[model samples]
Target: MPVNWRLKLKGFGPFDTQLDWSMSAGSAKVAIYAGNGQGKSTISRLFRLVENPQIPFPSSLITTGSAKGKFSFTVGNGSADLGHVEVDSSTGVDNQLDYLFHVFNSDYVRDNLQSRSYSPSGDIEGYIVGKSNIDLSNERQSLEDVKRKGIDARSALSKELEESKQELVSLGASRVKEFQEINVDFLMNKTVKEDCYADKIEQLKAVDELPDDAQAPDKLHLDDSYLDLDQLASLLERPYSKANFAEAFLEKVRRDAEFIEAGMRIQDGDRCPFCGRRYDEESRLLISQYDSYLKDQEATVIAALKGKQAQLSRLIDDYGRLEAQMLRGSSSYGEMRRGFDDLAKVEFPVLATTADFTTVVNAVIDEIATKNEDITLCVSSEAVGRLRDALGTCQSQLRDANKLIDELAFNLGKSKSRKTTLRKDACAELGKRIRREHREAFEEIASLRSKYRLLEEELKNKEAQSKRSKKDAVARLMANLLKGVFGNRYTFSEADFSICFKGETLGKSADSVLSDGEKAALAFCFYVASTWELINEEEDKNKLFFVIDDPISSMDFNYVYSIMQVIKNLQDTFELSRTRVLLLTHNVAFFNMVMGTKTLNEAWMLDEGKVTEVKNELLAPYAAHLRAINQVANGAAPSHTTGNSIRQILETLMHFEDPSLGTLGDYLESDYGGRLNEVAYLHLICNDQSHGTRTFGYAQPPMDDSTIRRACNAVIEHIRDRYPGQLVTAGVEPSENNSSS
Candidate 1:
């Protein structure tokens, strides 16, 4: 599963208009050893593009003063020569290098080595730096099994569905092309298959063509919000009394009541209003009877009867409107009868008919008019009950009609676009007809499709479960790795995903207490542990690539061996075809340690923009120190770890001269050449930088670039003056750090 890759990049950081590199197939393990500022990190950035070409590989990565820069990557036997990625143009790449290369760089450190923040209630939530988890291999395996089954089911279903479709076509069924031509809304948002192939097929088959000659529905429309008639009946039939008078005298007086009443009001000082003469006592007393009749309950009765008359008039107009609405509904029903045969014949309610309502209302009006003329007449409760009963019967009938109308309305909605709807229905019916003719093929297709859908759902659920399990597994590994590296000083909690120092959680204050080397070790342990995500034996058959960039840059000697052991374990665990670790580093000591002697053939030195396969001796820490000193003497600014290289050069030279001297400061006692005070200060500078003891930025400021260059030049001169033969023997090609002198 080893992949062959060729990369050509132009104008990309410290690379020029020409930077081409290739990895041969079967060359799984490789190294790019370089000094710190020589741009070896660019290799990691290039590796990232294979996974995601659109990651912010911006113009800033291009060297300055270039119009554009392009890179081409050939993956998997160079047959897949993915097109150029133009940083300025934003052009994309297409490649088949699918080997999962887990990259560990500053970017990865920023993303995955999570920072845990605490809440107000003392609960630690993450983005967590540490993990709490269990081994989830079983869960992961189960998911893999489910995924395989789901994929297989989907494939089988696809084959069967195609076969069924062809069978239907042979059996004279319409092609789904026609279904696609129709507007999607016609199916009310259903898929073409569901609309044409499934439930609707049966309904359409039962009802072949549109029905003609159907009867009108039993009731066209219902107005459940009808008025109450019981109150009206009570008002109409209530009893009233007139003045106490003889019947014969009442008849005459009732007609002349108004005239008689006016005469009585004018009877001031016994003067008559009827004639120009004063009224006698007998006439005055007789006219007083008219006033009594007008003021009595009989007057109230007449006013009440008139009110009832006005209500009846308004009822007549309302009844007419109700009739018009009913007529319209009946006409609509008759029209609908021409299509939908399920509609029942309608016999509209009398309450809905304005004529029937008017008849009942008019009868009450005429009766009330009679009572107004004769208030002495008896109030007939029987007649009132009879009229009320007729109105109540109409109200009940209207309600019954409303029920039938609702059912009819629902059916009519379906048949509104009768011709077009029936045609579509008939098409579905044709599908049903074809299925009946070729039942075997159709059933097989349906069965497979159903199973496929079920399998897909199961696969998704299992995947979710497995993803959670994998995180727990990563946490389990992280806890073991941290404890292994730092011992009891740093403990990782699987329960809360917290990294604690001496039983206390390390938050933002961790940097103040822990050394830079300790922090680097924690991050590296986590990075090595997180590679478990790619450990899928069942699904991923291809090899995995681990591109680790500068894993131990800032580490001290105490923690360096532990870091080397973790990387070694990582190599041993995912061995041979399973993994390919391409480690890029500036630390010659680290490179030699990790590669050992067996992997020297895979070691390559990268300088400027060129790569050359080098021997094991080329990466010696002694030679590396000499190079750093030379670069500084030539006025190059020193890198963060350059002080360590400087210190190693002096310490190795002085010890080679006489192993009894423990420190560079002891050189003063030996009467070495050059400034003795300057040498003592240089010794102090090297020790302070090489050992990260004082708080960062708390000690004296860093030596200026000029002072560092002069100090480095002086040390090189002092080395030449004392031990000139050692540099000639050690050579420019590096060798491992030697302590057996």
Candidate 2:
């Protein structure tokens, strides 16, 4: 129960200057009156902000050109500071203020009003109370987790089983069913009790035979000794005694051939090519020496050596061709090819060299007495033996290679069976365990889901029961309040836990319906009734504060009176001495009605950035003006705008109490017997001066303030004398300085 005892504002909203409001002791109800735009609504918005402190103070609340402002409220009768907020800086109040104050304004009515259909006895299925049921939520989440885990387990088991079957297929199992039906433990633990075909595999690996396509080394025939080339050179020497003379003449001829070939034709009288001189006796002598040297027997022996070198080159070329063909066919015989290559590389070069062949042939020709003597050359026994030994090595290597290939093929065949057996055993073990665990997990998940569903159903039932009880109570209170406000014009019934209006339910015309005013009235009745119900149910009723702003706005005059009665009833129900209420309005009649009906402990008038305490007792606006005019005539200083004030008072009196009286001028001319012309004249002066314009036919002579004040007094006297009991006067006790008209 935090009550606002005082409020201090600086540069806030429309109040650009500092403003303060204080509630006197024992003041449980206060009435504040302000014309439009006088900070009345600003105060209401501030109260809402204080209740909901999470809302930031509006930037527009700061006065123009002001960077910052602050507001502080004193709470309760002890004047403790409840909150102090700087504009544009802080959120005003906290949630501790909730339910302590309730404000209702035109916006609240518009936001909450709606056409709703209801049935009181219907099940309250969607009602929510306080926080959610945590136990129910936790149960649901736990069930979901179980289901997720079960799905994962099932998927994993299925995957493992499929992979195991695939692995068995890769190991050459013809069909999965053959191994799937076998006992996993027995198959894996059993040893190889049957023959593994080891002896046959070993025999295959050890057997060796050369391939049918294997070739033998070619035969070689070498002579018993190499020929001596130097002996052949002696046999070719000239037998003449003039050998040196012939040798010198050959040397001279050899030098002259170079000069003759350079550019000179070798004619009988040709010039030497190198020196550009005619050939002389020395050049002719050199040419004759070449002719004689060409007839020597040494040329024949040199030609025989060249022919033998050509024969050796042909033998080497034939050997190379044969060796390449042999190696190409040795792909399946590595050892055989290596042996042949080694033998060929070492021995073939000796017979291939041209120089070696030439020396051997020359020596052989020199030893033979005749050129036609058959010279047979045969290979040495040792060289032939080496060739035979290399062929034997190749044949042995072929046998070893054949044995190794057989062994690999045999082992590969046996491994296929062993791998298939292992895969079957693994698939059986893993698949069996996975299926068992997956079944258990799925069963647990199913059981949990079923239990969770039951618990949720029970929780919903309990919530429904609690909601129904609360709704029914509110419906009953609303119906009762509606009866007090509308009487028998409309029937009030509770349906779907809401108040409904009915004219036909009471046997009236089918088309009879509630007007807009009636609807608003009913809505207002519901709101106020529900609020009272809450207040009554509150633990500390005395702590409650109600703020209602312009409750009867846009309401019919009759309904406004009814609203006043309703408020009066509420005051009596909750004693004003104990409960605090703040009523603010721009409606003068409604404000006066409330003030007149209830005992307001304090009153305030707000205008032009200022708040002033009002000492006058509760009175209608017309009566208040009349009282003010009476004061002005009694030597009190006149209000600056007393002219317009008096005019408004007379108009209000005519409109409400005497409708036939018409305008103020008509009322003065008719009801007062034409004796109150000066009062009417004063009214016209007030209207013209207040509006800053001259009304038509209001060009009478001007009167001073004293004369006008006197005329206001005379009009009050005439109203009292003429209509003695028609007007309602201010309720203040009579005093020397204060008087009611």
Worst 10 residues of 2 by lDDT: 341-350
Question: Residue 225 error for model 1, in Å?
Answer: 39
Cα lDDT tens digits, model 1, 519-606, are 7788788776666565553234245667788878578876888877776666564444344667788877778876774442377777
Clashing pairs in 1: 132-494, 217-346, 218-346, 617-734, 618-734, 620-734, 620-735
CA lDDT, candidate 2, residue 425: 47
Pick by lDDT: which candidate is best? 1
Lowest lDDT sum, 10 consecutive residues, model 1, at 116-125
Q: In candidate 1, residue 502 scores what lDDT?
A: 85
